[model samples]
Target: MTVTAPEMANGIFGGVFNLNYSGDKNRLIWHRHWLVCISCGAYAGVGCFLFAPRGLMYGFVASLFTSCCSIWADYVHIEDPQHLAHLVDRWAAFHFFFVLVCECAYVLHMPIWYLTMTLCLALALFSLSRSSRSRQSWVLLHSAWHVLPMGLLLLPGLIS
Candidate 1:
């Protein structure tokens, strides 16, 4: 019984896309979204390492928090993930975004930070509120929550 990479990945991540999940809707959605969220955090860490080496610690912390949350989801099959996931999500996001804001603190006069914050908040709230209504919407919006900050955070470094 050779467990190949694909098999291993499937075993660990299979629940991510399988929305049906024994006719339980919400459970699988959060699990899947958190997987994407962790990926985003990991990518952000890599981006920090490449561009803003100094922020690698912050990125790592953010990724680790989300990873723990996701791992917990995988560890236990639960009816609802919202309770713990929300707390972990907020903590992880706060650390990531707070570091981002501080890094760009010198550019306080710029509107990009304000705009990014507003958009992130809006997406987070919208995705959370509508999570139960539509899995697709929540997935997309939640993914945006992960990617948007990474893009903005790394853009200036890439451009300059």
Candidate 2:
């Protein structure tokens, strides 16, 4: 019951490759976010490995990066009205690959708990960014999501 690109596009009420102007703009923004997420995830993963030696954290960061890439691909398909379905299909395929990689990394103890927690936070931010209709709201939500987890993670250390 894996969803196909055509199915997703139909569900979203958009043609297989025919995005409206707004859709295109949104897709562009999403792409930029994907780049940022990937970069951050890589850096965080490296940090965990070098400083924390936590496999869960690495896996989590990797997962976040994978999710962002998937979302970016989805938006790209949605924005390209002429071949929307293809983009969606490609994204789905890519997601499957990355998810597998993340799982393997997690099982192998390549990432630690803190990294996993941060990854979850990153995922939440990504969701909020996509869900928000207004730029201001998106930014606010992103900042809040990023800050809250960090504060919570640091609180224990501070209290001790």
Candidate 3:
């Protein structure tokens, strides 16, 4: 489905993943909302490692953690994401590094094609998130955050 589909037009994928900023900054600090993507990805990645270690399980799990940290930090902001955006950027860099580590370790070698697609997809998602303005879009971006992690979890078994 088109992420910006008019019918679902409020959250990330639709109104389903919509986010609302807390009016009081203090309201968000400890009472974090349990958003969907990262939480689900964390569980899925952990399960993948436990059931099937034929891939870069560690890398994937770490990737999920960084995502959760960035996201939780973004939403439940005791701090502002704008000034601290670099931390999220660093987290993103680490995520890719971990994914590459997994491919190198488990797959022997990663083809240029896979790596190129990874870069392209990352850039695309980043662009989408940055350009998106609506709460719905933020919701969608955060909700769709699992795409990369899930792909990481599955890549090993598919290739190997």
Q: How much lDDT does candidate 2 score?
A: 0.44
For every candidate, C-alpha RMSD to the true structure in Å? 13.5, 8.9, 10.1
Please give, for residues 109-150, the per-residue lDDT of candidate 1 as tens digits.
Answer: 335655477556645543453344566665665555555655
- The C-alpha TM-scores of every prediction are 0.51, 0.33, 0.51
Off by over 4 Å in 3: 1-52, 55-61, 82-89, 92-108, 152-160
Candidate 2 lDDT, tens digit per residue, 87-118? 55445434533553454345443345654666
Q: What tens digits encode model 3's per-residue C-alpha lDDT throughout 34-143?
A: 45334334434533553336455655556555555655455455235333543553455456555554555456465566666665665566446445555556456544
RMSD of 2: 8.9
Off by over 4 Å in 2: 1-122
Per-structure clash totals for the candidates: 0, 21, 5
Q: What is the lDDT of residue 2 in candidate 2?
A: 100
Model 2's TM-score against the true structure: 0.33
TM-score of 3: 0.51
